[model samples]
Target: MPTISMTVNGKSVSGEAEGRTLLVSFLREELGLTGTHVGCDTSQCGACIVHVDGQSVKACTMFAAEAEGAQVTTIEGMANPDGSLGVIQQAFQDNHGLQCGFCTPGMVMTAADLLKNNPNPSEKEVREYLEGNLCRCTGYHNIVKSILAAAATMRGEQVAAE
Candidate 1:
């Protein structure tokens, strides 16, 4: 087992992991962050997405040891310190972007990163950028709308104050 050290959900953590242990497993099993779900074992699904060094990465495709010295942010870390939902998460909830909630965490995290990179994304741009994330619920229309709405809110544009 290789000992890996990294910051997860704003807390520094060190642990021993098998060479083949994926980061998603490390988060869900060892760190008790079950919010990051594994919808598919293959990396094609973005359900296991998380922030690594400020970039969204598929945790299922990365080994825990490979994340040593990096910073990881799971869905559980997206909320405010007081446990209030983050703006992106709020947007998802307000817009009904989630149905089963299995993909919401990853979608919210990816949308947060997307908005951070480009605050005002067009509908086409949002669809294009979110191609990697698959949502079997809500038909993705609401998800796109939620992301755009969140983007507007983040940019201080008037979004009717929902």
Candidate 2:
């Protein structure tokens, strides 16, 4: 087992995991962070996406040991300290961006990272950035709207007019 340490959400965590243990498994099985879903074991599916060192990554594609000393943020960590959903999550809900909900976690995670890097993304940019995340429900129209709306909200703009 390899000793791995990282900050999850806002708390520091440390554990011993097998060298080959995927980050997704470590989060779900070891840390009980089930919000980061595993829709497809393959990396092709973005359901296992998370933030590592403030960047988005597919937990299924990385080993737990590799994340040592890195900051990790899973879907469960994206909410406010009081447990209320983040703005992006609220936007998804308000816009009905999710249907089956299986892909919502990853989508929200990716969207959060995207907005962090580009606070004011255009509609096309939102769609382009979300290309890696697949949603079998809602057909992505509302998803795009939700992302844009969330960006607006983050910028302190009113969504009621949009």
Stretches of candidate 2 exceeding 4 Å from the true structure = none
Query: What lDDT tens digits, residue by residue, belong to model 2 across residues 10-82?
Result: 7899877998999999999888889999988898768999999999999999999999888999999888889
Candidate 2 has its poorest 10 consecutive residues by lDDT at: 153-162
Clashes of each: 0, 0
Instruction: Please give the TM-score that candidate 1 achieves against the real structure.
Output: 0.96
Residue 95 lDDT, candidate 1, scale 0-100: 90
Give candidate 1's root-mean-square deviation (CA, Å): 1.2
Candidate 1 ranges beyond 4 A from true positions = none
- Model 1 lDDT tens row, 63-135: 9999999999999999989999988898888898999999888898889888888888899989987878888
lDDT of each: 0.90, 0.91
Tell me how far the alpha carbon of residue 63 in candidate 2 is from the true structure, in angstroms, after superposition: 0.6
